[model samples]
Target: MRINQPQLIDSTLREGEQTPSVAFTDQDKHKIIQGLCRIGVDEIELGIASPLNTYLPNLVKEAKKITAGSCRLSLWCRCKAEDIAFAATCFPDLLALSIPVSDPHIQERLGKDRDWISKTLTASLQQAWAAGIPAVSVGMEDASRADTDFLVATAKIAQQHGATRIRLADTVGICSPARMTRLVQTMKEAVSLPVAVHCHNDFGMATANSIAALEAGADSLDATVLGLGERAGNCRLEEVIGYLALVLGEQRYHPEFLPELCQLVAESAGRDIAENHPLVGSAIFTCESGLHQHGLTVNPDMYEPYAPERVGGTRRLRFGEKTGARAIQLQLHKAGLRLDEMQIKDLVHRIRSGGQVLNQEQLLRFAAKCC
Candidate 1:
């Protein structure tokens, strides 16, 4: 498939806030927005601006003062006149109005039908346009579950009402890569405006689906720092960006700032960065397996895809239960020690059983013991 350079729309401030017990202070917002700009993301979705939170107004005002055009800032709100009016007051670079498009959501959630959904979307778009909003987009909530024909119709309504873009949300994370690609291709054919994909990780496919969507002509994709959001959270910014850079040869984003960005988000969100999380995780670049470590000692590229420094991380050779004799010998050499094969074999045996790696001081004691 032909690769498309898709724009990343980070929703760390919007959907990310929906994570349980997570709220960003004004300072948190500034740090995250600044980091996103530093990493060169195309846009950032600020939190919903409707219902007028006590802090949101002040947050938006502060964001305007601090952002200074590093990236476009947009606000997300429901498809209602009141929400759009409140969102307009924030004066963001763009406005995104979310509307549910599935039959279940239309009939059960809102007690409305497809016609009502279309009209509500049209009316909301009209109101935003008349209010002189800079740019408007429609977010199709649960688009994966919506009927394909009805989904196209919804996109048409948004396009008719002056939407510059439309987002297809896999609200439940049920779509596969193939399904995501097909959906994006269909939407691209059906609509003239740019199509964006927003995926959830209920089935652990958010990142894969997002990549598939972009490969199939999606113009944009949504991600949150460390994948923070409701339930299993949204697509992870680090994973998607890493894949694009290391595998797909896309370089629109600055991956070097990922470690710092993840740390910032983790601090504010009260979330721990998993040691095994890709890219920014602590142990992603560390090797402990005997065979892998042996191969790594021979050549760093023997097992590594790209350098750890590429993402502002360091490569480490861990000496642990799974470590091999070569790894142990290497560590010993690094500590300025040498031993015969027999002595090294005895030490390796003890290490495998229970011997801990010695520091320089402990190594001196060990050398005296051997003597």
Candidate 2:
């Protein structure tokens, strides 16, 4: 069954900050929070709560004031008493306690066994609840590599411990969509709490995996603007939301705010938006291929998946080395100029030889000379 309305927990402030050399100042964080609120995200992960990160408490306070309960605010914490204590001070609506369930992380990184993880997780949850935190989500770090039975057992523990949600993380970005589908399905079947998925893009399938999870009845998905995170980043907020709104007819998200939201995050992250980046890219709507251009002129739906305006973009047809006669004639006619078959063919040849893309006005100017 398709999840018509999946909750989006935007992690731009949390996971996005993990990107190397990226930091959001107080003002930047507030602006981004407001931007995310305007886009109607169900929740916003403010950032991690740590003693060394001294600004989190005040940031969460200000974010709460800015959002005023319109959106739920969450904080990421390790499955440690200290982290849970620090997170409680922030007074976020939810605390996401990240625990490594994979053997490599549990046995090698922490040098502990499954018993230690359960003890640590149980203690952390008890600590958060004792501090009067409203909700908690158990994030299973590296769950993609964890044994399915162990994952289910861990999820059961989380549910028993009063976690409001269970988040499965593809920590290494290695989970395929098919595997992701089965994993989410299994987790959902095993637990009564809401299931969320967090995917990385190391293998470039984060968005696909997220979609598969949603298809398998995931209640929520995590994403960051521009997919900014460690080592290739997380699932992109724009790509997932775009797919939901445009493909599955999920209407809770507003695609129009994506361009501005992504631009804001990009600027703050000191990164440039790729021209061909999906959904929010500046040049995605610009087409130059002869066949595509001709098809667009004939019927835009033939080549375009959806209208450019759907995502606050404009469509542009440009002529270059691949320009065809029919496309050239159509563009010329639209400009109130009629070029015969021979003239159109000659113009196409000149455009092809020049090897530069020409807009409608430039093509008109070239056509005047050719005729």
Candidate 3:
């Protein structure tokens, strides 16, 4: 499925931290919220609220204080009276309650019947409404694996109980892109509320599944920066933003600050940037192979789908076993120096021959020495 266009994009603050190993400190949270605002995200999920867990109230207090008016803040909760009431104290712009629609979670996780699940969700949603928070939504936890009739039945109940949206969580990350499309469309047709899709990356189809959900009538997505989340992760925020802007021709998000937002997330999550991760990965804009280097010299378009500048990156010439003289010359040119053919060849030969690894500072020092 293909997106017709993008409406709005949320950032990786709240859901991004859902990655088991990725936890953000209060300072990190402040930085991430500011960065998301800079990148023009319409919303940010702060965190989940549960008496079943501690720490959400203070996080909400800090998040609300940091973000600008342009970014709406949200919180997630379980579909229970206490959970809903616990979260409403924070006074978030939106409250999303996760309800188990499948027999497994309904029976196993909650130890309750389907009829009981419906009552729980409706009661929780009404509680949020009474608190003067205008927005309420329900997440169909493990919806992708659930029986269709049950999922739709749950969404209709949510809509009837003052929920303006329903989220389908591929909670276990087992959903395929096609299955995502079918399931999202099925629930979307069942209710008048907005539809949101949350996908995990277990099968490496999170982004594809998100786009497919949008194609099948989902109006919103749950994505994370650096694709940080439980297990493998959730839908990657930067990848989805790029695809929407470059491929789908939607400019709903601002691109000028993408790298800043990425950097903020990387620091907050305490994860080093992986070379091969899409979009925000350090190597995403770096060229190494001779052919790629040569083609990039002729036209960056030959090697890159979108200009690196759009994501706050400049083209990088990675000095390695595969680099050529053209790449060396380009790097030198950026340093306000020029190396003729023989000089360029020498640098490439040494780099390719495994003489030394070149970081930006090392290359700059070498260029200064030559001058």
Candidate 4:
């Protein structure tokens, strides 16, 4: 199947702040926005446009300056006339008005019915338009669990109400890739408006589901840096962009900017980037297993999906207890040192007995001393 090149909407400034104990200062937000723009994302969701968030207007202004109109800036708001009215004051390029479409959220949470959902959504879109908002999107919260028929109906209503886009959110991260594909396909067939997917990572399928949605013809995907958000967080910006650029061969995004961008977000969130984190981790391209090291020594492509430099990473081999004799010989040969088989075997035993991982320089020094 031909993969669609989808627009990326990075929501780090908005959804990422929902992470516990995370509050990005103005400087942090500006830096993140600049970083995101450098990566060439299509849009950025700044934050909620509530009156309490007094910095939103200025944030939007600064984002405009940073992006210089190359990227669109958006503000999120609830499905209320007041929220739409306030969000218009921020002068964002787009306003995303969100409401629940599932039975649980509509009936139990909001104490309302589907009819009220349609009414409120219609009113919200109209209000945003009346307030002179240039573009508007309607988000269906808990859409993964919503009835398929009702979801189609709601999307049609959103389209009829002049929404430029419709966002389907996996509110609790219950969707598998197959489910997300079906949902996006159905919505695409039902509405002419652009379809966007927002997936959560409670089940660790946000990135998978998001890719599935794009393959099924979603027009956009929502993501956050480092996957920072409530609970298990949202789809990771780096993971999605990396797959698009490296695997799908999409040239619109720059995955090489991910390392620095993710580092900035991790520091602001007071979170540590796991060494094995896909795409931008410090050690993702580092090898320790003896078998893998041998493959890398022969042809890095045998073990690596792509060159580490594709994402601004470097390939590194570490020697340890797991290192095989052939890998040690290969490393020693690269350093212009040769040893007899017996000597190499004895050195391997000693290194394994030591039970420590050694870098290239350390392994070379150790081999010189022992051999």
Candidate with top TM-score is 4
The parts of candidate 4 lying over 4 Å away from their true place are none
Candidate 3 lDDT by residue in tens digits, 307-362: 98787777776567776776667667866777777777776676678666676567
Model 4 TM-score, all chains together? 0.97
Predictions: Cα RMSD each: 2.4, 1.3, 4.0, 1.1
CA error at residue 210 for candidate 1, angstroms: 0.8
Clashing pairs in 4: none
Off by over 4 Å in 3: 1-13, 52-62, 318-371
Q: How many residue pairs clash in model 1?
A: 0
Indicate which candidate wins on lDDT.
4
For all candidates in order, the CA lDDT equals 0.86, 0.90, 0.77, 0.92
- Model 4 Cα displacement at 24 (Å)? 0.6
Candidate 2 ranges beyond 4 A from true positions = none
RMSD of 2: 1.3
lDDT (Cα, tens digit) per residue for candidate 4, span 137-213: 99999999999999999899889989999999999999999999989989988988999999999999999999999
Query: Candidate 2 — worst ten consecutive residues by lDDT sum?
Result: 339-348
